[model samples]
Target: MAENQWSTAITSVKPNEIRVRGYRLDELMGRVSFGEAVYLILRGERPGAAVGRLVEAMLVASIDHGVTPPSTLAVRNAASTGASLNACIASGALAVNRHHGGAVEDCMRLLARGAARVAAGADLAAAARALIGEEKTAGRRLPGFGHRIHTDDPRSYRLLVLAREAGTAAAHVGVAEAIVAELAAGGKALPLNVDGAIAAVLADLGFDPELANGFFILARTAGWMAQVIEERRREKPMRRIDQGAAVYDGPASRELTQG
Candidate 1:
């Protein structure tokens, strides 16, 4: 490409503009924080205050779900197997593509669906059970309600409790809490794991259900890198073989047989 062709084409801000990318920094500065800026960059509009803050919190919270995170584990596994940098990163993405990394978003959808019923005073327990039943009928696994880790994700519960105290949309917070309590009492002790917590807090704050998971994927990518870093430090990554295709009788499975 021509030198600075794109630079000249895009200049939203000048030196005195105090801009980001092209926006005037001074004007858009307090109008939105870094979190809002993030939204603006990705979606081209500043989200509402609640949304901005909640999205930021979700982003901050999405990182490093310990080494068990498949992305992290994939990186480590790649390192152990002697994968290339690209391959290692690819592994991380592969891991996230599965449900493990995307559960928060799935949970968000469940909460929103349940939220309407809860708002109508459908009974929190009933709402949860109904939601789970609906999901089971759809042949889908329920997302954010349960956790494999904590008996009760204390962090999520604590955040929900605090969000309720924050002004505006407190009822949504209550609804989220009620759903959590109902599910916890009925199902496994899993009380609002990370996904559920993010879903509740973001939904309460007014983020779209999808944004919750996208933000999580963005943050979890870092954890993947962290694993790669650790693996690199210990020993270079090893590319993992797709065991499904490993051929044992390459010679015996002759051209005619292969064809």
Candidate 2:
């Protein structure tokens, strides 16, 4: 294949002309909110008011958790090392994976599966219960259920409320609620976290699961930039982090031995 043969339906560009999802880029600049633009670019259509709110809310929800989040730490650390803003932000984004700031994709997949099961006639409650049980039995924690800090994530609650008010709450939301109920029934009060809530809401809004993590990266980029800027302004260059606070339970330092 020739290089010019590589094509994209997302955008069309020529001299003095730019189009995205069939709209002139200049037309979209002031008329559409960033959230609406994001939806239009990714989903190929402008969102209804509710979807706009939902997308905006999703972006706002994960903007920052604090300095302790891996992404923030990465940004701060790189900034302390005198990295450029772009490099610091890139380092921050690179820290997002399954363990930190990455539950959205996993939660989206889970919610999608639950929604499908419900569409296939399984009761929401039953499906949720069974799925949660299977995950627990497999020693896997539900991606959007628990948080290390908040007992209840305020952002999750607000997003759900907005989704309901926007008339966008549907099967995936039901599945998420049912999962919460199932966890409650099992005496594990794992409330839905923001990642899970966003997954359900976005699923209801018809997003493909593959876009879930990308959405997170997009949203959190703002936070990374902010944190990087703050670190550069407030912290000394290459500040030494004390490792003494970490507990050492490993084997004692030993001399080399012949096998």
Candidate 3:
């Protein structure tokens, strides 16, 4: 927002138009599906139609899941207390932190490393094992391989199924399957959750990992905007929800006298 400031989500907020990374919207329209456009916007060029369409569809599929999503719940809470739509949306987005949307980026990093090892002629399973080992050694869970909610995340499985059905490659799809399989072989059922599958599919299509978060945020933005708009239409704000400030429980100290 300052002079010379820019973000790689690829936007020029001039001429009353937004060109995501220099490609005009008009040129992208109909020529690419929403997923391809998303890929192009983030990566600077469109991938093949099949891959692009698959990614776009994944984005669309995740837009919103009723009032259950935290963002939507935050918007609703804001509406209940009489807050502006934008304010409600900001509040909601504030709640989604490193723990939530961060997995895709982490997962992609692991895959990139594992893929490199595999490409260098290491066995695929061995590379995956090394990847998991490295993450554990770092005191973290292997990202993109599991979820907290589902015994095996059905949402992820369904999305991957659809992406594969839409002609996403077997190899990329196999990466996801292999991760799940490897996890299972360890006597764990850490299925490929949404983040892992998304990472594998996107990486297969050649998008940079830097674009991963932006692509995810774009999809999340739609859901956020929709909830914000809905809250706006409801004509009430969540004054109570935004009322309280933090209760400090840190160390208390007596005032020090200057010597």
Candidate 4:
């Protein structure tokens, strides 16, 4: 085989035929919902109707968190520089890293580990308590359990309720609930955030935890484009290149001396 040769089973295009994960594009058009299509492309199979609905809810929850997010700010700043729309959106996506939009994946890994412990014969609540204790011992802040702005994340609560109604709540949801209960027993009242709820749902849906952040990025692209267009329309070019109120917190200004 050629060293540079690459093969993929994801998609194939040849002579007016396009297939995604074994499904003909023509057949899927106007048939599968966007969320199902996303699942098909990523997971190699389309999700069931209920799972598709849950996927759509996750996308909606991640779409935007106001214009104050770093991703949105990056997009608007790039738009101010007269960059192309694609560039602006790319900038925004690039800004979503471990600190900004990474909790979904993090929480998914935690949930998976806890579920495995339960499957190995440990009591569900006991496993959850042990996990929390381990995290606390390591001085690691638990992700997806708290929010800076919301005392109780309405999105998280709604997603859980919907999951119950959809009959899709499974071991992952139970483990997540157990973790919450353990936290409350410790007198730390941290409500689950949207990322945490999405993490649990994705686990129940059998998605790879590694893809959680990517899903978030895919959903947020729509919001980034909207912000880019709005910034281009309402703001002046290069308007924020320099903020007049910036302060120098370093050493006093010094003059260069001739050698």
The top-ranked prediction according to lDDT is 2
> Could you give candidate 4's per-residue lDDT for residues 83-142 as a string of tens digits?
999999889989987657778888888888888998998887988898898889998877
Model 3 bad stretches (over 4 Å): 1-24, 27-31, 66-72, 158-175, 225-259
Model 3 whole-model lDDT (C-alpha atoms)? 0.67
Give the winner by TM-score: 2
Q: Rank the candidates by TM-score, best first.
A: 2, 4, 3, 1
Those runs of model 2 whose alpha carbons end farther than 4 Å from true positions after fitting are: 1-4, 240-259
Tens digits of per-residue lDDT, candidate 3, 38-153, equal: 66766677777666668866686556655555556665676566677667766666655445654677777778787787778777777777777787789988777665565676
Instruction: Give the alpha carbon lDDT tens digit for every residue of 1-259 in model 1.
Output: 9886755423365455555556776778667766677766765666777667655666667767666666767767876776776788777767764267677667777778887887888876677778766877999766765666677776676566545544434444555566666556766444667777776776776667656657666777677777677667755446453434333432453576667
Clashes of each: 12, 0, 9, 0
Clash pairs for candidate 3: 35-56, 78-238, 81-237, 81-238, 81-239, 82-237, 82-238, 83-237, 83-238
lDDT of each: 0.66, 0.86, 0.67, 0.84
Range of the 10 consecutive residues with the lowest summed lDDT in candidate 1: 241-250
**Every model's TM-score:** 0.69, 0.89, 0.71, 0.85
Candidate 3: minimum summed lDDT over ten consecutive residues — where?
239-248
Ranking 1 against 4 by TM-score, winner: 4
